[model samples]
Target: MTTGQIAIIVLILLGAGFMLISAIGIVRLPDVFSRMHAAGKASTVGISCLLLGAGFFFLDEFLFYRMIVLIALIFATAPISTTALARAVYNNEPALRRQLRHDEMAGSVAEAISAPPADGDDAILTTPS
Candidate 1:
């Protein structure tokens, strides 16, 4: 009914919508990369809108600044962190269990682990030294 009430409603709607859409994306997406995209987009926007709007509703300058800073922190870290996690999973996924063909790094660890023992000159000697 009031302007403040309207703003609060709008903020809630925006945050809820983003979260719901993200949930759908996570459930409906076909693979790891796409799911990560969906989660990152929804959560970042949802947190920014929700925290920023709560700051406005609270009418405190410190709260507002804190909310904005928190949003900035999320944006600064969430995507890159999530992307790296996804990349790690993609790169190190189990060979026999993974269905993906784009994993060039998938077998790197396995190859290293399975490689034959190096000869005397090539092997490291840690005795006493």
Candidate 2:
């Protein structure tokens, strides 16, 4: 096989390996936050690598650009979405709060949870009005 083919295979295998580890982490983790962390970080990298391999294999300018865009989107959105989901889950689920050891967001999240909803707003994390 050509060097390029070998490189493509390596990227695919690396991506698949990361995905496999992420799947295992999601299944084995004890909490929703941990599982989300695993799914978010590892899957983003795995999908990016897989897309890169596919882009190389196709060698079409249009498709390659699309693949790059997809990778960028995944990298850009995964962490933000993960953080939002974590915050939402933490605010909604009291049991999850007890599992935290450090509680870095304690002050902010606690304030948000306890603060009374503003006029026409019922969300837990409310903005100052």
Query: Which runs in model 2 stand beyond 4 Å of their true positions?
Result: 113-129
lDDT of 2 by residue, 1-129 (tens): 999999999999999999999999999999998999899989888998899999999999999999999998888888888888987887776667767786666557646665655673455343222
- Top TM-score: which candidate number? 2
Q: How high a TM-score does candidate 2 get?
A: 0.83
TM-score of each: 0.69, 0.83
* Per-model RMSD to reference: 8.8, 4.5
lDDT of 1 by residue, 83-110 (tens): 7777555434443225655545444544
**Which prediction has the highest lDDT against the true structure?**
2
Q: Which ten residues in a row have the lowest lDDT in candidate 1?
A: 120-129
| Model 1 error, position 7 (Å) | 1.9
